[model samples]
Target chain A: MLVRFWGTRGSIPKAMRAEVVRSKVIAALVAADGRRFDSETAVARFVDEELEMPVAGTYGGATSCVEVDGGEGDFLVCDMGSGFREFGIDAARRMAEGHSKTFNIFMSHMHWDHIMGFPFFGPSFDPEVKIRFFGGHDDLEEALRRQQEEISFPVPFEWLKANIEFNKVVPGETVEVGGYQVSTVKQYHSHDSYGYRFEAGGKSLVYSTDSEHKDDDPESEDMFVEFFRDADLVIFDTMYSLLDAWTIKQDWGHSSNVVAVDLCSRAGAHRVAMFHHEPIHDDADIHRVHTETIRYEELIGRNSRLEVLCAYDGMEVAL
Target chain B: MELKQETRERALIVAPNGVIDHDSAPAFEEQLHKVLKSADDGALSLIIDMKDIEYMSTVGLRVLMRVSKRAREASVDIKVAGMNACMCEIFKISRFDKVMQVFDTVDAALAG
Candidate 1:
């Protein structure tokens, strides 16, 4: 299974501000410190090795879109956040290359940020495409349709030429789609959300975002631990600090990296990816959070083999 | 969570100690409702003294937003005071600061 992140930011989409780019450039220049590079390769090496990741790279600004390639002819996507635009264009290119134009979109919830990219998804307008949306929400169809209403959007939902289907999934029930087995669990979030687990080719991947874990709910925590057990990769929502999540952000429906580390360690997952970054947080803040989460994992001394990676747009992890 | 209420010069001061989270938000909301229920019915002003509050979450923020909206409909003024730097940052990032006035001290909230 190959997992790719199209967007990682939570709440809303944002671009790096001019000042932020300026600061990174300044930091890179300072790190260079009168050293002259003769070629672009040397500059690339300096950016990759000499400067910190936050100073050289970005987590990107797209919101909540992930693609899981299961070696199947069809496409499998999780959430259609603003990042879907890029995915759609890529799919169109693939279609032009004589590939199947079927899309299986697994929605966590119908929050605006999650579905905002659907209207702009180019494939939906292509008559050759077939799109299937799966979710646990009863009002899933209505919610999607409402967003494309004439009052809210210029295009009507009915105007889409693709063959569209809505599948209402019940919690704990596994569905075989293409070559993967997909399962979902109810999550704690405003208006409720669902976490999906995908299994294919003897490899497992879990996509769980916009869900908060409560300390008082030990049973639920244990359930989640079981839900994520022995997965190759677990993409988790780490949108706030432990201090923030536990204190003032309680019931905010988002978990912290601290909780993610503990859960993944207990679940014996191969790797945990910190995801759904806070929009207000800059790359430096995210780097700090990622570092602190790793430190917290070591502090607990649960399992030294558990891997941690911060999810960034355009990053791909294969299992 | 412990709530201490004091009526000072036509302003109702609500002081909540400890963390305001999922488990405690309901109790916090209930306490505020009780105070509002008992207050004289002309025009109301509330000053939330958060000096002793160590933490808060979006659930707690929702309670504040809900209560503030109700207060607004009733022509009441809601102000917050004594938020720690962390709490202030959360409020600012969440944009809750735009909905209510925040002050460093109770006197400042009351005066403003």
Candidate 2:
């Protein structure tokens, strides 16, 4: 199984501001100093090795949307955030190249940021495509339909040409979808979010976001550890600083990198992809958060092999 | 956990000593709501004095946010006083300072 991140930001979509990009460019130029690159390869090497990650790379601004490839017949995706638009375009390109036009979208919840991309999803307008939506909420269809009302959007949900289906899943019930075993667990959030676990090809991946971990209740903590137990990868919501999450942002339904590291370590998860980045955090801020999380993990003396990854747009992880 | 309640002027003061963490937040919340219920009909404000509070976790903060919302709706003022430097920093970062008034001392809170 392989995981591809189309979008990683949370709350709202944001584009890199011109000033932010200009700062990165200026920083790169200053680091280059008197050096002159003879070719594109040399410049690329400088950016990769000499420049800091924040200056050379980006933790994209798209919200949610991840694709899980289990080598199956249909496309399996999680969340239809703004990133879905880009993923839909790519899927359309694949369909143009003789691939099947089936998409299975597993929703974490119907928050505006998570479902905002559906109307822009290109394949939904295609007559030959089949789109299936899965979630724990029985109001899944109504929520999606309401988002496309005439007042909110130019395209009505009824006008969509694709054959669409909504599947309501109960927590802890495993379902077979495109040869992958998928399960969900209720999470603590304002609107009742869910964390999904997918197992296929001898690997397990858990996508858990928009959930807050108070770490005060032993039973709830144990349940989360069990849900994440021995998974290959755990995609977590690390949207705030530990201090913030524990203090002012309490019950705001977001966790911090420190909590993720602690939880992943306890669960014995092999790897953790820090995800659902706070929209207000800049590239430098995210890089610092990721760096601090790695350092915190090392300090805790967990499994030496446990890996930490900061999820970015277009990043692909193979399991 | 020790909780002390006092009535000062038009404000009801609740002072919690020791850690206001997950284990203690629920009890604290219950006590607070009980006091609020008794003071609901009056035009009294709510003041949380954190002079002896050693630590407060997210669970503790949730209780405050909930109370703050209710206080706003009821036109009741909520003030946090006697927070140590560390607690003050936490409040600022969480933006709780914007939602409620914070004072350096209980006297200052009462005066305000």
Candidate 3:
């Protein structure tokens, strides 16, 4: 199984400002110390070895779309955020190269950010392609259709040429979809989001975003730990700090990196990716949060071997 | 977890020792709530002295937060003081420093 992050930003899409890019360039040049690279390989090596991730590359601006390739058959997509547009283009190219045209998409919720890319999905206009949407909400079709209403978008849902279908997934029931056993769990959110767990070929990956973990809710935490138990990779929403999540941002439908690490460590998951980064955070701020999360994991990971990863746009993990 | 309770300057001081983690959080919560209950009866303020606390996990922090919320509801002024370097870092990284009123010392918390 392979997992790819097309977008990792939360709340909304946040493009990197020109000044931020200029600062990164200045920082990189300062680190280079006026030394000239003989080859592209040398420059790559310098970027890899000398500069940190924030100074080298961006975490990106796209919001919450992850592609989980099961290595054969139909492609499974987690969300349809703005990043889905890029994923759709690449997927269309793959289909043109004779790849599968069937798409099995798992919708976390109908939040605008999670479904905003549907209008731009290139394959949606293709008559030969088949798209299946699976979600815990019964209003999945209605939500999609409403988003494509004439007042909202120029394109109407009925005008789409693709053969689209929607299936409501019952929570706690594992259903086979796209050559994998997929299960959904109800999450705490304003409109009630659902987290999906996928298992195939003895590998497990849990996609859990836009969910809030209450500071004092032990029962809910235990349920989440069970949902994340012994997974190879858990993509989690680390969109807020503990202070914000507990104080001003309570009930905002997001979790913190500290909670992610704690839950993943408790569940004995091998690796946890911090996904759905706070939109207000710059690349440097995200890097700092990731660094702090790693340190927190070390502090709390007594007898637990959990690897912490910060999910960036275009990151791929294979299991 | 063992909590030492005392009253000083019309404020109730509850000092917790050792690690406040998953195993000890319930006890800490119970003792802290009891202190909050007592403070609501008479004390003008409540101070959690963490000078002897070696570590605090997420659960422990949650317990503190719940207690703080209860204190606020009860109209009792609650403050935290005397965290070690590691605890301070934990608060800083978790952003709990902004959530709660933290002081360098018990005297500072009392004075401020």
Candidate 4:
């Protein structure tokens, strides 16, 4: 499995906000256990060694694109943000070089930040590539269609040459696409949003992109506990500060790292990728968030054998 | 885990108002099956007062789905009402929603 992050900024994209310039915070990643980079010195070394150009979060960037392929391999990327444009180029180059045929793009919601990168996704331009898009909204087709609405697009949805399969499933319904077992639960957002749990090649990965965790309520807590149960990896939407989550952005659809780290440990997830970085946050803020998140996670009692990580553009994890 | 049958006309409304777990699942299933059989006199409907049931399990689903299947086969009506969200997800998972017509009130079930 190869998980890569092309973008990490949350809310809307900001370019000049110092946070955007020094954007060393990586709230997204690609997952494949090619190697482990856990220590700060190790990460610094990798950023200095592996990446030709160290990329960080930029406003109007992509969230995360994970390409998992082994037994029943998959090219499923979550959120079609600006980062997806780069991933799309990668996939397109792979396709040009004869990489894979079918690609499944799963969207957490149709929010602008999550959808802005679609027009730039290069695979959609390829005649031979197929894109299977999945999401939970009242009308999945309309959401996809609206993306190509001519008010903004030069071509219509019908004019697309590439086959884009839209799968709209009800909550609790499980769908097996190719060899991947995709289980979904309606997550907490103001309107309808979906959180996906993917099980493939004996590995379980849960993507909770945009969710709000109000652990004060027992029902909400139980619902989360039930949804996560036991899992290996969790990509969570930790887009707000604890102060913002509890105060300013009270009902906004995102979690704080406190909620993210705590929920990951509680749900027995082995690792967590803290994603959907707030646009105002820079690299130092990320380090601080990590410290604060670990503090809150410790307050929940230390039974959790969990790994927490920050993501940035072009970061990859092999598991 | 006791058999508490409350009769409504010829219809037998088995109101097993508690959490149906392993400790109580068999008794609940058996007793409900009996009530369903006795209500086979072609009553208009067989109602399960799920109003008081705080929780229902996969084992409990065995009872509901069986009764629903039998009632459908016998040409007698079977319906459940007043389920909370927790129990509703159980039905949604088993896809019991499409098979059984659920309502919020007994009158609505009887009327349907």
Name the candidate that leads on DockQ: 3
Per-residue CA lDDT of candidate 3, range A110-146, in tens? 9999999999998999999999999999888999999
lDDT of each: 0.87, 0.86, 0.93, 0.68
Per-residue CA lDDT of candidate 4, range A246-299, in tens? 545768877877567656766888778888888776555665665555544544
* Residue A225, candidate 3: C-alpha displacement in angstroms: 0.7
Candidate 1 TM-score versus the reference: 0.75
Off by over 4 Å in 2: B1-112
Which portions of model 1 miss their true places by more than 4 Å?
Answer: B1-112
Candidate structures ordered by TM-score, highest first: 3, 2, 1, 4
Residue A288 miss distance in model 1 (angstroms): 0.5
lDDT of 4 at A46: 62
Q: Which ten residues in a row have the lowest lDDT in candidate 3 chain A?
A: A297-306
Off by over 4 Å in 3: B107-112
Question: Interface root mean square deviation for model 2, in Å?
Answer: 6.4
For model 2, residues A81-130, the per-residue Cα lDDT tens digits are 99999999998998898877888889999999899989999999899999
